[model samples]
Target: MPAILDDFPVLTPVTDEDLALAVQAVRVHAPEDWPHGTLCRSERVPYPCRLARWGGVTLAAAGLTDDQVSALVGTDA
Candidate 1:
């Protein structure tokens, strides 16, 4: 018996192309007032726009360094 259970893997391998597609989906589905709109007005960032957030999580889960995700998302520092 272990002190902590591994449970299940929530993160899976993802490719750069996948991330790109997610980003595109976000952009395509973003509302006119997105990025600044209230959550009430929109239900969880709408359809594809939610992909951006999902992409970030997936990128991180795929073992990508923060810098890598940022670079892919054009937020490199």
Candidate 2:
């Protein structure tokens, strides 16, 4: 039987387009100096910012590993 994770598409080796979309999503949704430390509050964040954060979370949940996510953000995820 196939594993549940297998049911979801895996973005193996990630791609430039993926990174672009993530960045764009964050830029369009999130506010300047967004995603601050734990001190940050969600309710204060913009709707689009929340959506962008959700999008990244969704991608990670789908199958994107920390490394892959890091590549997208140009950091060590």
* Per-candidate local distance difference test: 0.51, 0.52
TM-score of each: 0.41, 0.37
For residue 61, give model 1's deviation from the true position in Å. 1.5
Give the per-residue lDDT of model 1 (tens digit) for 5-54.
Answer: 33322344566676666555434434344575533223454443344456
* Separate clash counts for every candidate: 0, 0
Please give the lDDT score at residue 54 for candidate 1. Answer: 63
Residue 15 displacement in candidate 2 (angstroms): 13
User: Which stretches of model 1 miss by more than 4 angstroms?
Assistant: 1-11, 15-17, 23-49
Q: Report the alpha-carbon TM-score of model 2 versus the true structure.
A: 0.37
lDDT of 1: 0.51
How far residue 3's Cα lies from its native spot in candidate 1, in Å, is: 32
